[model samples]
Target: MRSMLLRARRLLGALLLAALLAPAGAMAGPCGPYTTGNIPDCEPQQQAPVPYGILETQGWAYYCTGDHPYFWGLSSSYPGDFTWDNSCFSAIENVFPETTPNKFDATFTNWCLSAENIVVTLGCSSQPPPGFGPSCNETGGPVGDPGCPQSNISNHCSSTNPPVCFQTATETCSDGTTYSCTADQGIVWCYKCG
Candidate 1:
Protein backbone atom coordinates (compact mmCIF):
# COMPACT_ATOMS: atom_id res chain seq x y z
CA MET A 1 0.00 0.00 0.00
CA ARG A 2 2.91 2.36 0.74
CA SER A 3 4.47 1.56 -2.60
CA MET A 4 1.18 2.32 -4.38
CA LEU A 5 0.93 5.65 -2.52
CA LEU A 6 4.40 6.67 -3.72
CA ARG A 7 3.47 5.87 -7.34
CA ALA A 8 0.31 7.95 -7.04
CA ARG A 9 2.31 10.92 -5.74
CA ARG A 10 4.66 10.73 -8.68
CA LEU A 11 1.74 10.69 -11.12
CA LEU A 12 0.24 13.77 -9.46
CA GLY A 13 3.52 15.70 -9.84
CA ALA A 14 3.71 14.93 -13.53
CA LEU A 15 0.15 16.08 -14.06
CA LEU A 16 0.92 19.34 -12.26
CA LEU A 17 3.98 19.93 -14.39
CA ALA A 18 2.02 19.43 -17.60
CA ALA A 19 -0.71 21.77 -16.42
CA LEU A 20 1.83 24.52 -15.74
CA LEU A 21 3.45 24.26 -19.15
CA ALA A 22 0.29 23.77 -21.16
CA PRO A 23 -1.16 27.24 -20.68
CA ALA A 24 1.95 29.17 -21.73
CA GLY A 25 0.90 29.05 -25.37
CA ALA A 26 -2.56 30.34 -24.60
CA MET A 27 -1.15 33.14 -22.42
CA ALA A 28 0.93 34.47 -25.27
CA GLY A 29 -2.08 34.62 -27.56
CA PRO A 30 -4.47 36.07 -24.96
CA CYS A 31 -2.02 38.94 -24.58
CA GLY A 32 -3.21 39.90 -28.06
CA PRO A 33 -0.89 42.51 -29.58
CA TYR A 34 1.99 42.70 -27.22
CA THR A 35 3.70 46.04 -26.86
CA THR A 36 7.32 46.81 -26.14
CA GLY A 37 6.03 48.03 -22.81
CA ASN A 38 5.18 44.47 -21.82
CA ILE A 39 7.87 42.52 -23.67
CA PRO A 40 11.33 43.87 -22.85
CA ASP A 41 12.95 41.61 -25.45
CA CYS A 42 10.80 42.89 -28.27
CA GLU A 43 12.69 45.19 -30.61
CA PRO A 44 11.41 48.53 -31.84
CA GLN A 45 10.08 48.39 -35.36
CA GLN A 46 13.03 48.49 -37.72
CA GLN A 47 11.06 50.43 -40.28
CA ALA A 48 9.46 53.32 -38.47
CA PRO A 49 7.26 55.04 -40.98
CA VAL A 50 7.32 58.81 -40.93
CA PRO A 51 3.81 59.85 -40.02
CA TYR A 52 1.93 60.86 -43.18
CA GLY A 53 -1.34 60.25 -45.13
CA ILE A 54 -5.07 60.29 -44.33
CA LEU A 55 -4.72 56.81 -42.95
CA GLU A 56 -1.37 55.24 -42.12
CA THR A 57 -0.87 51.86 -43.80
CA GLN A 58 -0.63 50.53 -40.29
CA GLY A 59 -3.98 52.30 -39.64
CA TRP A 60 -2.89 55.37 -37.65
CA ALA A 61 -3.61 59.07 -38.11
CA TYR A 62 -0.72 61.55 -37.72
CA TYR A 63 -0.23 65.20 -36.67
CA CYS A 64 2.52 67.81 -36.76
CA THR A 65 3.75 70.98 -34.99
CA GLY A 66 5.44 73.20 -37.62
CA ASP A 67 8.65 72.22 -35.84
CA HIS A 68 10.05 70.50 -38.89
CA PRO A 69 12.67 73.12 -39.89
CA TYR A 70 12.86 72.25 -43.54
CA PHE A 71 9.42 70.69 -44.04
CA TRP A 72 7.97 73.62 -45.90
CA GLY A 73 11.08 74.02 -47.99
CA LEU A 74 11.15 70.32 -48.66
CA SER A 75 7.46 70.23 -49.48
CA SER A 76 7.69 73.26 -51.78
CA SER A 77 10.91 72.20 -53.42
CA TYR A 78 10.54 68.45 -53.44
CA PRO A 79 7.04 68.24 -54.85
CA GLY A 80 7.43 64.59 -55.75
CA ASP A 81 8.70 63.57 -52.32
CA PHE A 82 7.11 66.02 -49.84
CA THR A 83 3.38 65.99 -49.13
CA TRP A 84 0.65 64.57 -46.86
CA ASP A 85 1.30 60.90 -47.60
CA ASN A 86 4.87 60.76 -46.34
CA SER A 87 5.05 59.48 -42.79
CA CYS A 88 8.00 61.55 -41.45
CA PHE A 89 6.55 64.83 -42.70
CA SER A 90 3.15 63.51 -41.81
CA ALA A 91 4.03 62.65 -38.19
CA ILE A 92 3.19 66.12 -36.88
CA GLU A 93 0.30 66.62 -39.27
CA ASN A 94 -1.09 63.22 -38.39
CA VAL A 95 -1.15 63.74 -34.63
CA PHE A 96 -2.61 67.30 -34.74
CA PRO A 97 -6.31 66.47 -34.57
CA GLU A 98 -6.27 64.88 -31.14
CA THR A 99 -5.50 68.18 -29.44
CA THR A 100 -6.94 70.89 -31.69
CA PRO A 101 -9.85 69.07 -33.41
CA ASN A 102 -10.67 69.16 -37.11
CA LYS A 103 -7.34 70.84 -37.88
CA PHE A 104 -6.15 68.73 -40.81
CA ASP A 105 -8.14 69.81 -43.86
CA ALA A 106 -6.25 67.56 -46.23
CA THR A 107 -7.08 64.50 -44.17
CA PHE A 108 -10.70 65.58 -43.68
CA THR A 109 -11.13 65.63 -47.44
CA ASN A 110 -9.16 62.36 -47.88
CA TRP A 111 -6.82 63.96 -50.33
CA CYS A 112 -4.12 61.85 -51.95
CA LEU A 113 -2.13 63.80 -54.54
CA SER A 114 -0.40 60.67 -55.67
CA ALA A 115 0.63 57.43 -54.01
CA GLU A 116 4.15 57.79 -55.39
CA ASN A 117 4.69 61.26 -53.89
CA ILE A 118 3.55 59.99 -50.54
CA VAL A 119 6.09 57.16 -50.65
CA VAL A 120 8.94 59.48 -51.59
CA THR A 121 8.12 61.86 -48.78
CA LEU A 122 8.53 59.18 -46.10
CA GLY A 123 11.92 58.91 -44.35
CA CYS A 124 13.15 62.18 -45.87
CA SER A 125 13.71 64.80 -43.19
CA SER A 126 16.76 67.05 -43.44
CA GLN A 127 15.36 69.55 -40.95
CA PRO A 128 12.57 69.88 -38.41
CA PRO A 129 9.42 71.86 -39.04
CA PRO A 130 9.22 75.53 -37.99
CA GLY A 131 7.50 75.23 -34.60
CA PHE A 132 8.91 71.99 -33.23
CA GLY A 133 12.48 71.55 -32.04
CA PRO A 134 14.12 68.61 -30.31
CA SER A 135 11.36 68.44 -27.73
CA CYS A 136 7.57 68.41 -27.87
CA ASN A 137 7.16 70.37 -24.61
CA GLU A 138 9.03 73.44 -25.82
CA THR A 139 6.41 76.05 -26.67
CA GLY A 140 7.15 78.04 -29.77
CA GLY A 141 5.66 81.28 -31.00
CA PRO A 142 2.59 82.62 -29.10
CA VAL A 143 1.00 80.77 -26.24
CA GLY A 144 -2.57 79.50 -26.74
CA ASP A 145 -1.65 79.65 -30.38
CA PRO A 146 -2.09 77.23 -33.27
CA GLY A 147 0.71 76.80 -35.78
CA CYS A 148 0.53 76.18 -39.56
CA PRO A 149 -2.02 73.91 -41.20
CA GLN A 150 -0.90 70.31 -41.27
CA SER A 151 -1.17 68.65 -44.67
CA ASN A 152 -3.88 66.43 -43.24
CA ILE A 153 -5.93 69.33 -41.89
CA SER A 154 -5.28 72.31 -44.18
CA ASN A 155 -8.45 72.53 -46.27
CA HIS A 156 -11.02 72.75 -43.48
CA CYS A 157 -8.97 75.06 -41.26
CA SER A 158 -8.98 78.25 -43.34
CA SER A 159 -12.77 78.32 -43.16
CA THR A 160 -12.88 78.46 -39.34
CA ASN A 161 -13.32 81.55 -37.14
CA PRO A 162 -9.81 81.77 -35.65
CA PRO A 163 -8.47 80.47 -38.94
CA VAL A 164 -8.14 77.22 -37.09
CA CYS A 165 -5.26 74.86 -37.68
CA PHE A 166 -6.35 71.56 -39.16
CA GLN A 167 -3.91 69.43 -37.19
CA THR A 168 -5.72 70.73 -34.13
CA ALA A 169 -8.85 68.78 -34.98
CA THR A 170 -9.85 65.73 -32.89
CA GLU A 171 -11.07 62.34 -33.99
CA THR A 172 -12.92 59.47 -32.36
CA CYS A 173 -11.14 56.19 -31.86
CA SER A 174 -11.85 53.05 -33.86
CA ASP A 175 -13.52 51.67 -30.75
CA GLY A 176 -15.83 54.71 -30.80
CA THR A 177 -14.36 56.08 -27.60
CA THR A 178 -13.49 59.74 -27.03
CA TYR A 179 -10.24 61.04 -25.55
CA SER A 180 -8.85 64.56 -25.24
CA CYS A 181 -5.30 65.67 -25.76
CA THR A 182 -3.04 66.44 -22.81
CA ALA A 183 -2.18 69.88 -24.22
CA ASP A 184 -2.86 72.04 -27.25
CA GLN A 185 0.27 73.95 -28.23
CA GLY A 186 3.46 71.99 -28.65
CA ILE A 187 2.93 68.33 -29.37
CA VAL A 188 0.78 66.88 -32.12
CA TRP A 189 -1.54 64.34 -30.51
CA CYS A 190 -2.25 60.98 -32.05
CA TYR A 191 -5.63 59.54 -31.04
CA LYS A 192 -5.25 55.82 -31.71
CA CYS A 193 -2.63 53.15 -31.17
CA GLY A 194 -1.18 51.09 -34.00
Candidate 2:
Protein backbone atom coordinates (compact mmCIF):
# COMPACT_ATOMS: atom_id res chain seq x y z
CA MET A 1 0.00 0.00 0.00
CA ARG A 2 2.87 2.42 0.82
CA SER A 3 4.52 1.68 -2.53
CA MET A 4 1.28 2.50 -4.38
CA LEU A 5 0.96 5.81 -2.49
CA LEU A 6 4.58 6.74 -3.34
CA ARG A 7 3.95 6.01 -7.03
CA ALA A 8 0.79 8.16 -6.97
CA ARG A 9 2.72 11.08 -5.37
CA ARG A 10 5.41 10.97 -8.03
CA LEU A 11 2.82 11.04 -10.83
CA LEU A 12 1.05 13.99 -9.26
CA GLY A 13 4.32 15.93 -8.91
CA ALA A 14 5.23 15.30 -12.54
CA LEU A 15 1.81 16.38 -13.74
CA LEU A 16 1.96 19.61 -11.70
CA LEU A 17 5.38 20.42 -13.07
CA ALA A 18 4.27 19.95 -16.66
CA ALA A 19 1.23 22.16 -16.15
CA LEU A 20 3.31 24.95 -14.61
CA LEU A 21 5.84 24.85 -17.44
CA ALA A 22 3.19 25.29 -20.08
CA PRO A 23 2.62 28.66 -21.77
CA ALA A 24 1.25 31.31 -19.41
CA GLY A 25 -1.57 32.21 -21.85
CA ALA A 26 -2.75 28.66 -22.34
CA MET A 27 -5.77 29.42 -20.19
CA ALA A 28 -6.67 32.40 -22.42
CA GLY A 29 -8.90 34.64 -20.29
CA PRO A 30 -9.06 38.16 -18.79
CA CYS A 31 -5.96 37.21 -16.70
CA GLY A 32 -6.76 39.37 -13.66
CA PRO A 33 -5.62 43.07 -13.68
CA TYR A 34 -4.10 43.06 -17.15
CA THR A 35 -6.62 42.29 -19.87
CA THR A 36 -5.84 42.20 -23.61
CA GLY A 37 -6.29 45.92 -24.28
CA ASN A 38 -5.86 47.17 -20.71
CA ILE A 39 -2.43 48.70 -20.95
CA PRO A 40 -1.17 51.67 -18.90
CA ASP A 41 -0.67 55.14 -20.42
CA CYS A 42 3.03 55.13 -19.57
CA GLU A 43 3.78 52.65 -22.37
CA PRO A 44 5.49 53.75 -25.57
CA GLN A 45 2.97 55.04 -28.05
CA GLN A 46 2.62 52.90 -31.16
CA GLN A 47 4.37 54.94 -33.82
CA ALA A 48 2.42 55.48 -37.02
CA PRO A 49 4.17 54.76 -40.35
CA VAL A 50 7.58 54.99 -38.58
CA PRO A 51 8.81 58.51 -39.09
CA TYR A 52 11.23 58.44 -42.05
CA GLY A 53 13.70 61.00 -43.48
CA ILE A 54 14.65 64.03 -41.36
CA LEU A 55 11.66 63.51 -39.11
CA GLU A 56 13.10 60.12 -38.23
CA THR A 57 16.46 61.67 -37.55
CA GLN A 58 14.92 64.22 -35.21
CA GLY A 59 13.01 61.48 -33.40
CA TRP A 60 16.21 59.51 -32.81
CA ALA A 61 18.00 62.63 -31.60
CA TYR A 62 15.16 63.22 -29.20
CA TYR A 63 15.23 59.61 -28.00
CA CYS A 64 18.99 59.77 -27.45
CA THR A 65 18.46 62.61 -24.99
CA GLY A 66 17.29 60.66 -21.93
CA ASP A 67 16.15 63.89 -20.31
CA HIS A 68 13.02 64.00 -22.47
CA PRO A 69 10.02 62.87 -20.38
CA TYR A 70 8.05 62.11 -23.53
CA PHE A 71 10.51 59.39 -24.40
CA TRP A 72 9.13 56.97 -21.85
CA GLY A 73 5.58 58.15 -22.47
CA LEU A 74 5.98 57.48 -26.17
CA SER A 75 7.55 54.06 -25.60
CA SER A 76 4.76 52.98 -23.27
CA SER A 77 2.27 53.00 -26.12
CA TYR A 78 4.06 50.16 -27.90
CA PRO A 79 1.95 47.02 -28.12
CA GLY A 80 3.46 44.59 -25.66
CA ASP A 81 1.47 41.77 -27.18
CA PHE A 82 3.69 41.15 -30.18
CA THR A 83 6.77 42.29 -32.05
CA TRP A 84 5.73 43.42 -35.51
CA ASP A 85 7.49 45.36 -38.27
CA ASN A 86 9.21 47.54 -35.66
CA SER A 87 8.78 50.62 -37.82
CA CYS A 88 9.10 52.68 -34.65
CA PHE A 89 12.84 52.02 -34.40
CA SER A 90 13.55 52.57 -38.12
CA ALA A 91 14.67 56.20 -37.61
CA ILE A 92 17.32 55.20 -35.13
CA GLU A 93 18.47 52.39 -37.42
CA ASN A 94 18.66 54.72 -40.41
CA VAL A 95 20.36 57.77 -38.87
CA PHE A 96 23.22 55.91 -37.17
CA PRO A 97 25.77 53.88 -39.17
CA GLU A 98 26.35 50.14 -39.01
CA THR A 99 29.35 48.06 -40.12
CA THR A 100 29.79 44.46 -41.24
CA PRO A 101 32.75 42.16 -41.87
CA ASN A 102 34.01 42.22 -45.50
CA LYS A 103 30.96 44.38 -46.21
CA PHE A 104 30.16 48.05 -45.76
CA ASP A 105 27.15 48.88 -43.64
CA ALA A 106 25.80 51.98 -45.38
CA THR A 107 22.52 52.10 -43.51
CA PHE A 108 22.21 52.25 -39.75
CA THR A 109 20.37 49.30 -38.24
CA ASN A 110 21.74 48.68 -34.78
CA TRP A 111 24.50 49.96 -32.50
CA CYS A 112 27.70 48.11 -31.55
CA LEU A 113 28.73 45.76 -34.35
CA SER A 114 31.73 43.73 -33.22
CA ALA A 115 32.35 42.02 -36.57
CA GLU A 116 33.33 45.41 -38.04
CA ASN A 117 35.03 46.43 -34.78
CA ILE A 118 32.72 49.46 -34.53
CA VAL A 119 31.25 50.64 -31.28
CA VAL A 120 29.34 53.90 -30.81
CA THR A 121 29.23 55.38 -27.33
CA LEU A 122 27.19 58.07 -25.64
CA GLY A 123 28.67 61.53 -24.83
CA CYS A 124 32.31 62.35 -25.66
CA SER A 125 34.53 59.55 -24.52
CA SER A 126 37.49 57.50 -25.70
CA GLN A 127 35.16 55.67 -28.09
CA PRO A 128 33.44 57.41 -31.01
CA PRO A 129 30.34 59.23 -29.80
CA PRO A 130 26.93 58.29 -31.21
CA GLY A 131 26.60 61.13 -33.71
CA PHE A 132 30.29 61.31 -34.66
CA GLY A 133 30.13 60.31 -38.35
CA PRO A 134 27.91 61.07 -41.37
CA SER A 135 24.97 60.96 -39.00
CA CYS A 136 26.11 64.30 -37.64
CA ASN A 137 27.44 65.31 -41.01
CA GLU A 138 24.11 64.69 -42.77
CA THR A 139 22.41 66.69 -40.06
CA GLY A 140 25.10 69.41 -40.36
CA GLY A 141 25.24 70.20 -36.63
CA PRO A 142 28.27 70.83 -34.49
CA VAL A 143 29.35 67.54 -32.91
CA GLY A 144 29.16 69.31 -29.59
CA ASP A 145 30.53 72.31 -27.66
CA PRO A 146 32.34 70.29 -25.00
CA GLY A 147 35.48 72.47 -25.20
CA CYS A 148 35.85 71.12 -28.78
CA PRO A 149 33.96 69.29 -31.46
CA GLN A 150 34.90 65.94 -29.91
CA SER A 151 35.04 63.35 -32.72
CA ASN A 152 37.20 60.59 -34.18
CA ILE A 153 37.25 57.95 -36.92
CA SER A 154 38.74 54.44 -37.15
CA ASN A 155 38.88 52.28 -40.28
CA HIS A 156 40.77 49.46 -41.93
CA CYS A 157 43.46 51.02 -44.14
CA SER A 158 43.56 47.94 -46.44
CA SER A 159 47.35 48.32 -46.52
CA THR A 160 50.45 47.05 -44.75
CA ASN A 161 52.30 48.72 -41.83
CA PRO A 162 49.24 50.63 -40.64
CA PRO A 163 46.59 47.96 -41.20
CA VAL A 164 44.42 50.00 -38.79
CA CYS A 165 44.30 53.83 -38.66
CA PHE A 166 42.73 56.01 -36.01
CA GLN A 167 42.52 59.72 -35.03
CA THR A 168 41.44 60.98 -31.68
CA ALA A 169 40.23 64.54 -32.40
CA THR A 170 41.38 67.60 -34.29
CA GLU A 171 40.85 71.31 -34.81
CA THR A 172 40.87 73.55 -37.87
CA CYS A 173 44.34 74.38 -39.23
CA SER A 174 45.87 77.86 -38.88
CA ASP A 175 44.72 78.56 -42.49
CA GLY A 176 41.10 78.13 -41.43
CA THR A 177 40.82 74.93 -43.46
CA THR A 178 39.56 71.66 -42.00
CA TYR A 179 41.45 68.38 -42.32
CA SER A 180 40.37 64.76 -42.14
CA CYS A 181 40.91 62.56 -39.08
CA THR A 182 40.47 58.88 -38.22
CA ALA A 183 39.30 57.25 -35.02
CA ASP A 184 40.34 54.13 -33.08
CA GLN A 185 37.55 51.94 -34.51
CA GLY A 186 38.77 52.47 -38.08
CA ILE A 187 36.11 55.17 -38.69
CA VAL A 188 37.44 57.79 -41.10
CA TRP A 189 36.19 61.38 -40.83
CA CYS A 190 37.37 64.93 -41.57
CA TYR A 191 38.07 67.48 -38.86
CA LYS A 192 41.42 69.13 -39.62
CA CYS A 193 43.73 66.15 -39.00
CA GLY A 194 46.75 68.27 -38.14
| Cα lDDT tens digits for candidate 2, 21-137 | 643323222111222233221222222332233222232221111111111111222112121243333212222222211111122232222212112221111122323332322
Model 1 weakest lDDT span, ten residues long: 37-46
In model 1, the Cα lDDT at residue 69 comes to: 10
Cα-based TM-score, every candidate: 0.18, 0.18
Write down the lDDT that model 2 would get: 0.29
Best by lDDT: 1
Off by over 4 Å in 1: 23-25, 28-189, 192-194
Instruction: Give me candidate 2's TM-score against the actual structure.
Output: 0.18
Steric overlap count per candidate: 48, 23
